[model samples]
Target: MLAPGIRVVRGPNWIWQNQDDGEGHVGTLCEIGRSGSTHSPEKTVVVNWDSGHRTNYRVGYQKQYDLIVVDNAQIGVKHPNIICDGCSKPGIAGIRFHCADCSNYDLCATCYGNDIHDLEHSFVRYQTANSVGVRVPPRQGALKIQLKGIFVGARVVRGPDWEWNNQDGGPNKTGRVMEIRGWDNESCR
Candidate 1:
């Protein structure tokens, strides 16, 4: 049932329900590590957590209690194309700043700066829909500056929603556009 790109719902581990050792933590199953030999029945399920921790559990062992594959449709995770709350533009990959208080209130980097949103409201800047590590925008505007070059060594910066790949080059790293490749996220690349 577990597969790559499939988000899993890790249920409460009964053994450690009372303890707070992060045993019942929820995360995505990243990989299925081999058990050395090809005939080996046991395998490791590598789970990458939202808290930035990677833990490996036995496949059969965890599946019985924790780790249920999440159906996006059943869980109401399916969004009908994210439109910028400020500009009303469809598929704005750069939409990063979000109002925690408001329901579904999101703003692109451009609009977040140009428009005067609630000054008292707190904002969380993220690169994608399923990114973790919420933090206030370091400053205003996009996470990275726009560049003209697309080739290697061309100084380019990441936008607010630049987490298309498993890559987060991080903020304020004035690095060149390493690659110009097609990404699955149409809004991003």
Candidate 2:
């Protein structure tokens, strides 16, 4: 589900029947209407457009989406002078992970989730953009093991353990691992 302060644009399925004037406009999600509520039975999102226009749009009403998420970052939280070391993004969004062992080293949620930094070192997870951060130590008794065969850019296919529906084309579909997250022993990607 989308949260407030996320940047969005008009979806591919946008139509003139939409409640607001969001055509060719970029906006930030201001509020989300509760599903099955008295006011809004269908899922809806209120947007504050960059052009100073504010309006509500349908999310999944009638199986059609009106808004597309451009950037999932929460812009309400500001962290001055902090830049992501992995992607070099000027402002880290969502949960900011700071390496406890490295000085002035930080990673955004995407980078942290993709294991961009040294996994041997511990990290402090910042719940918000400007939070003091909560220390997240490495798992106990877990040995540091290298990925035997899989590496970034390596093409991989769905294995037998795949449980989800065929969302990536089909069973024979292949995709590359953009980044590897967590320890190899932890069974995370």
Tens digits of lDDT, candidate 2, 39-79? 54558878766545676778987777888654444444434
Instruction: Give candidate 2's TM-score.
Output: 0.38
Best candidate (score: lDDT): 2
Q: Cα RMSD for candidate 1? A: 13.2
Residue 82, candidate 2: alpha-carbon lDDT: 76
lDDT of 1 by residue, 1-189 (tens): 445443444444434332223443345566676657443235556655534455555556546444544322212222236677888866545335677767887776567666547655668765445656275643444443221223356664555436655354567665666653333432232
Name the candidate that leads on TM-score.
Answer: 2
Worst 10-residue stretch by lDDT in candidate 2?
180-189
